[model samples]
Target: MITIDLITGFLGSGKTTFLRKYVKYLLAQGENICILENDYGAVNVDMMLISDLLGDHCDMEMVSGGCDSDCHRRRFKSKLIEMGMIGYTHVLVEPSGVFDVDEFYDSLSEEPLNRWYKAGAHITIVDAGLRLPLSDTSRYVFASEAANAGVIVFSKTQLNNPEAPSNILKYLNESLASISCRRKLKASETVAKDWNDLTDEDFKRIESAGFKTYGFEKQQVMDEHKYESLYFMEKKFSLDQIKEKASAAINDPECGGIIRIKGFFKDAEKGWMEVNVTKDDFTVAPVENGQDIVIVIGEKLGKEKLAEIFGEPAEVHAD
Candidate 1:
């Protein structure tokens, strides 16, 4: 049976960044691994970020977003079953931020998959310097996702947020209480070191961080939740211009609770560059190649108003 290690976290929690590091570590251990990106977006920008990691020791696959919950899960299971036939010893799953955790276990516990794959590490990455007073929906998501995680790794501690480390813990426990989940994170089970400074020993611990079978209040999420992602293809804008417009949408109320804006476009001088922005940080980095598209993710998004902000999208894929 192949080991399927899951890396889960909330939106903009740096799951891709951490997964890149974890994949490299597995390859070093002589582990032939496959990365299954179960993303919830029209276009998976993350795939481009990790494309360079593809080679003999590792392979990559993705289940695209913009489908109903049941449809998405079926695709996820089908993809896993297909990948199971491959000769890899391990499969790393990076699901979308608002994924149904139950699907991860349910799919693996079924007939053919049960015989081919067993569960491995279940790690959840969190933003250390999180600004509090997150919407009730967002807080519920934060606790719900981390409820069964065997290890909780905090990101962006190196930036040194004043309220971090301690503040984050208090908020997490409170969020868990709201969800009525009995499980709570202990300090011993968490890794708070910088990603660059993370030693092999730290990764070894994460590798063996088997999941905890904990239960939480499972309510109908889609009926109440209003998360969305708006995509714009073939937009002509410089890096500076896009950043300015992205910041406006992220901060403005007309756009509705916008959480993250990310995508890629071509520039005159830089050729191809990626636009990755969250409420906390704004970063535009150069890439070798990219699609001329942008995606904006948030809850209860005002579609038409946003279209006016970033110009009309060639296509719109939303839930």
Candidate 2:
């Protein structure tokens, strides 16, 4: 049977970063692995980054526009079956940040999926800095992720005070105790640690952690209009200029509530550059070679406003 590990987290919580580290370890072990990347946006900029990093180490498949919608759900299941047919020892599923774990579990219980694959581990990535915002506004989704996770990993630990993650973990333990299906950890085991700081020994525990079962089922309804994406192809713009415009667009009242902005772009000075933006941070670096594509994901986006800000994109649509 194939082991399918679900890596879930709320928006901008660093799911991709966690996956990158795990995949590197898996590759070193000579594991036959596959990655199923699900993105809420129509464009898969994360995939581009993943490909650039991983190269030919593993097979990759992407399900764009999320798996929540009925059409995409069916497509997602079909892809699983296809992966099974091709044969893989492990399948790493990186669901879109806005996704619900319940939906993932429900799909696995059905025909074909259950026959071919087994639940391996449930890992949820938490952003140490964004805990409060996540708890306040996205409690349902945030809590649901924690409730279903067997091992909870944290990101952005280096950016926060040393005492903050403990407080956040305490809050999560209290908030999720009643709903979480996985076994509870003692106070000693509840602190959140940085992904980079984790050693190989640490990962063995996470990957081999016992599978969990979730019974609590309060599903969070997705606000369809709340998330939208704009895609740009072959757009050549100065990185500084793009950042300036994106900052303005994200701050604009008409295009506020932006969650993530990332893509590969052609830099006038550099060869190819990749940009990743979250609520807390923005990063840009030169890549050897990559597609010139820009994908912006946010809520309440105004096309005209964005066009003016980012210099008229090739296409804009809902994700």
Candidate 3:
């Protein structure tokens, strides 16, 4: 079975930016993945950007405008299945800015594609800079998509109003509570709320709510070793060397790029050490049993000539 993640957000809400980060994260974890882009208009900008960033490693599918409602979803599912048949281990869908999450979820929940694909996460991106209230339809649409999500990320914070994230979260919690009676809605709670607060009873409530919402299990700590985002470019080395270099890179003083890093690497011992930098700390995990892949997002560092920094490739394959 393939893990499918749906990325939803309003126009200019940083969906593409989030996707870029995510793709890098997956690549670093060495996951074989495909990206499906659904655009309301004629142009598929997200698809083209994904292709450019991931190159041959990503399979791109586009569902353009013109098809009837039913037909559009059918075509989308067909494209996903086709990508799955091609041996993609995971699929990521970036719906158009105008797409509604409830409709998309309902469509998938009732479909033939549901059997083959398990929804991993629904990530909705909101522009922090916009300073928009969730009451607006566009903002509501963004929140609705994330209402049942396993994870909700607010992107482009650098461009956002400082208080936007908190505002959005407040609205999201209330909305979620309104629709899901099982889970109690708490106000003024941040995403960094303690996991212990989510006791067994909370879990039961969440389960009963029909949406599985859980905090990331990893301990959230702020250490120099932690990173929010990191990026590596064209690093080639033996597996052992790749691991060593990654370890060293994570310890670098300049690791404050993002809370995570997503990039590609070639390793001699492991053939590849796709690195996942999670939680602003340099804790690394290999995805897909250590294959040659790119890292999309994890903990953070800026673009560096990884190939030159790391020495000697254990092997090379056509990309």
- Which prediction has the highest lDDT against the true structure? 1
In the range 199-261, model 2's lDDT, one tens digit per residue, is 788888778764466555454345454456677677666677668866787677786567777
Off by over 4 Å in 2: 52-57, 66-68, 134-137, 170-191, 216-220, 268-270, 313-319
Descending-TM-score candidate ranking = 1, 2, 3
Which residue runs does candidate 1 get wrong by more than 4 Å?
223-225
Residue 207 in candidate 3, Cα distance off native in Å: 19
Winner of 1 and 2 under TM-score: 1
lDDT of 1 by residue, 187-287 (tens): 88788878999988999999999999878887555435567778887777777778888988888898898888888878786688887888889877887
- Model 3 alpha-carbon drift over 4 Å, by segment: 107-112, 134-136, 160-162, 173-319
True-vs-predicted CA distance for residue 135, candidate 1, Å: 1.1
Q: What is the C-alpha lDDT profile of model 3 across 1-319, one tens digit per residue?
A: 7777787765555577667666766776677878888754443434544555555566777876543445566766667656656777777888866564554566566556677777776665654444334333333344455555654555545444566667666666665554442333333222222232334443233222223453211221221222222223344434555456666655554532222233345444443333433323333333323333333222333345333344332322110
Q: Candidate 1 versus the native: TM-score?
A: 0.95
